[model samples]
Target: MLLILLFFVAMWAGAQNALAGGGSFLTLPTLMLTGMDARAANVTSCVALFPAQIATGWTGRDLSRGAAGLSLRTLFIISIVGGAVGAVILLLTPPAFFARLVPWLVLFATAVFAYGSFLRKPGEANAHLSPRGAMASQFLISVYGGYFGGGIGFLMVAALTMAGQNVRIAAATKNVLAAVMNASAVAIFLFSPDLHLAQALVTSLGATIGGVVGARLLHHIPDKWLRIVVIIIGALLTLGLFLRAP
Candidate 1:
């Protein structure tokens, strides 16, 4: 029954990711209940959710866009390199250190993504940001995505919009980049000792199913309510993590 519960959690996480982002916020805690530490749970979640991310990226590829003066190719390269670096750093980090750090990381990502998702007015667009600036922003965000991606989708949306992309383009571009960065991380993690394959497989299956369901439900569900739910869940998870921290 525990495995069944985990599957349901994965399903919700997948739906949250497909609909509005913040999937990791759910997957991490549930993975922990299966006897993994914070860092291990994180690595496994990245692998488990990868397929769904790829599907989203592929389906929305046309809506993706480049920054002013920056080619999409350049952004792709940045994400790959940055994600690789972050993944290496994660492999080197001790589990105890990551356990203590994760709560704060989740809190920050959640707050930033929530702010980006709801607080910013849609009419306030900025498309003239320098390519160099956009390049730097993408690289940093990519590194974060590789290391501990909780609110990565919303983070990318915020950065792209700041770089002058429209919300629609920003959302689509983020999905593609998110998959790219996570792919780099998964490549490294496939060999990690911390990977929990059984749970990963179960979660992956559920996430894949949830992604499809979420896409079908996209038009029916109110995005505002989804964002609200994401925010509340993130806050609760953050509080729980902090309480469990040593």
Candidate 2:
């Protein structure tokens, strides 16, 4: 059972990375169902996902030349602040608050994720964003990402579309933002006594390898079918969270 669960975790993480969304929608719940306590599951997933984010970010850069770099650096700075604030909240707030909110947030994220492919119009290939608008939106989404990253890719995609970027560019930026938020939260969680560092490390390694492979395959794939698959997964994830929430 453990081995099978781990295999599912790797494949799910790989597919989610390939699709440019965070895989916490799959990983977090899986970990919890496997008997990890909720907080520990969240923290462990954050740690495991860090390496995946790095791999995906590098892949995005390879695909987009310097464009990915520009967007990544911008999103990273905003995410750092947001993640730190969220970590503080997690440490201080009641777990019940977050528990009640996760399902609703997942639902909203799914809706946003579903419409992400259409956010930009035809021929708007370049990002025509004002620096101020991009920064502000990045900051806001970072807060959301830091708190709960289920559909953070969609939020970032929405922000990028508002800034007039194409789906590809939005995706690259989303990867960077997800990386920063997870990294920050993971760092904070490392000091916790309850975290299982060994399992987390193993999971992170799997996610990293999967992310690199997925990034390599992203451009060659037909995204319409991929998008449909992701929407279905997102809906399932959303329903699962709702059912699990207290």
Candidate 3:
């Protein structure tokens, strides 16, 4: 029964990630409910959902091109390196400390995404970040993606849009970059003692299907609605994290 529930949860998470980026908020709690510790749950979630990210990214590959002044190759390298750093930090972090930080991190990501999605001026939609700013933002977002990964998708969308990509392109590009960033973290987590193979496998299958579905929906959804949905999910996840925090 728990496995069945996990499959459904992973489906939703994969679609949510493809749509906007708070999928971790769902997957993390579901993993914990299945008796995994927080750290283990985080690692397992990253590992299991990774393939879905790749599928989603692949479906939108034409739109997942470079952003700002940085080529996709450069961004991929940055994501790989940053993700490794974040995975190492996660492995070293004490559970209690990570718990204390979770709410604040979600809140911060939510605010940034909100501002970028809704509050920014209309003229700013086409604004481009400096080369340094784009690289720095992507690096930090990649690190966060490798670590907890709850709101990383939204963060990437926000950063990419600010760096001059339109919303659709930003969303597609985010999926690929996110997949690249999480790949390193997944490699590190594969050896984790706490990983639950059965759970990960079930989740992976469901997420893979959902990812394909979600990627297909990308072109159908209007740009305005996409941004609105992403912002709403981020805000709700922020509230949910705060309420669930100890």
Candidate 4:
């Protein structure tokens, strides 16, 4: 049981690092299937992802120079507001809405990631949206981010591409904003009844290790292959969501 659990955790870490989206979709379902309640699964996944984001941030600090490093203050402020708003929205809404929206959102995100090549220039830096607009999009994304971060990275990447930013800058900006969403959601979970602290801790440890490895290996990986695989997974997840619908 322990080895199996660790194996899943490791796989989750790799997926999280490679895609920056859909990591939770893989791990959370596994936890639920293993007998965790749905809410607990989300809480546990959030806990695991918190450290993973932190590790990514730390390891990628030097990579954020130039355009990516500019306007971080605006990004951070927008993220906080967006995270807070998203958290409140989650507390007020029923879970059914998320179940309905997730598939569409996943498919949209997948499309954006997969088609990023055709839509933007090769190695372009900050392509289309203004900094202010980018910040606003980040805030909006935080709303979704606070509830489920599955494809948040893809959304961020798209936003950055639309804004004419380079991939590295977009990725860096996405991580910072994502960290805000994760931190805020984690805080809410800490006080909520659904959290499983023990499970969260263990999963977090695994995610941390995986994040470090992912960050270190980021440059060497084939992003095109990774994006293709994630798109297929997202499509499948979307199909499941549709099938499960009434």
Candidate 5:
């Protein structure tokens, strides 16, 4: 029954990831409820959703180019390094410390996503970041993606769109970068004793199916409504995480 529930949760998460970026909020808790510790749940979620990310990114490959000042190659390299570093940090972190920090991290990401999605003017959509600033933002976001990954999709979209990409392209690029970053993290997590392969495998199947569905929706959905939906998901995830925090 738990496995059945996890499969559905991952399917929802994959679609959310493809559409906007708050999928981890659903998958993490589901994993924890299945008797995994928080840290284990985090790692397991990353691993399980990785294939779906890759599939989604592939479906939107033409749209995965970098923003105005950022090159896809540079972003890819940054994601790789930052993801590895973040994974190491996650492994080194005391479980209790990570538990205490989870809610706050989710809150911060949610607030930033809200400000970007709702408060930013539409006229400001072409606002461009300097090369250094763009790289730094991507690196930081990649690190965060590796560590916990709750709303990293929203973070990536916010950063990319702020850096001058259209929202649709930003979302697509985020999918690719997300897969890149998590690839590094998943490599690290594979060696960890905490990972639950059975759960990961089950979730992976559901997530892959959902990824294809969501990727198809990317081009069909209006940009304004897409952003709104992403923000709503982030807000709800924030509230849920806050309520769950000890």
Candidate 6:
């Protein structure tokens, strides 16, 4: 029954990834509810969501673009390197410490999402970021994506809007960049002691299905409402994590 529930949630998360990002906001907590430690759950979530992110990114590949002077190739390389560095940092952190830190991370992610979704004014569809700022922002977000990635989609949206991309293009670019960011982390986590293969596989199956279906439904779904729903979830999740017995 739990696994069944998890599979369905994974599907929702995958769909959310396709539509607005923040999939890990679902998977990380769901995985934790299964009794895995935070570090293990985080690792497993990263692996499980990788395929769905790939699918989502590929489906929207045509719309993706970089900042004014920064090419996609440059962003790609930055994501890879930054993600790897963050993954390495995660690898070295003590499990207990990470468990303690999960709540704070989730809280921060939730705040970022809220800002992007509600407070930030709509940007011009064609506004481009200054090249240097875009590159630096991409790297930092990549590092965060590799680390926790709960609200990465919105974070990318915020950054991309500054680079002259609209929400749609930002979503597409983030999907691709997200996949790239996780690629290096996945390589590192593939052999780690913390990964839980069974859970990861289950999520992978559900997320893949969701990614495909969600891509098709992207045009039909109300993105703002979905984001609002996700924000509510993130807030609740953040509170729950904080109140949870350490």
Best by lDDT: 1
lDDT (10s digit) by residue, model 6, range 122-228: 64435556889898989999998888877777788888887877677887898899889999999999999899898999999988888778888989999998888
- Cα deviation of 86, candidate 1, in Å: 1.0
TM-scores for all candidates: the values are 0.96, 0.80, 0.84, 0.79, 0.85, 0.92
Ranking by lDDT: 1, 6, 5, 3, 2, 4
lDDT of 2 by residue, 128-222 (tens): 55767677767777766666666677767666765766667666766666777777877787887646776676677667667667767878878
The CA lDDT of each predicted structure is 0.88, 0.68, 0.80, 0.65, 0.81, 0.86
Runs of candidate 1 exceeding 4 Å displacement: 122-124
| Model 5 deviation from native, Cα RMSD in Å | 2.8
Backbone clashes counted, model 1: 2
Instruction: List candidate 3 segments past 4 Å from native.
Output: 215-246
- Ten contiguous residues with the weakest lDDT in model 2: 62-71
Better of 5 and 6 by lDDT: 6
lDDT of 4 at 209: 67
Q: What is the C-alpha RMSD of each candidate to the true structure, in Å?
A: 1.3, 3.6, 2.9, 3.5, 2.8, 2.0
Error of 6 at 141 (Å): 0.7
TM-score of 1: 0.96
- Top candidate (TM-score): 1
Candidate 1: deviation at residue 152, Å? 1.7
Better of 2 and 5 by lDDT: 5
Better of 3 and 6 by TM-score: 6
On TM-score, the stronger of 5 and 6 is: 6
Q: Candidate 5: list runs displaced more than 4 Å.
A: 68-70, 215-244
Ranked by TM-score, the better of candidates 1 and 3 is: 1
lDDT, residue 246, candidate 1: 88
How many pairs of residues collide in each model?
2, 0, 0, 9, 0, 4
Q: What is the lDDT of residue 240 in candidate 6?
A: 91
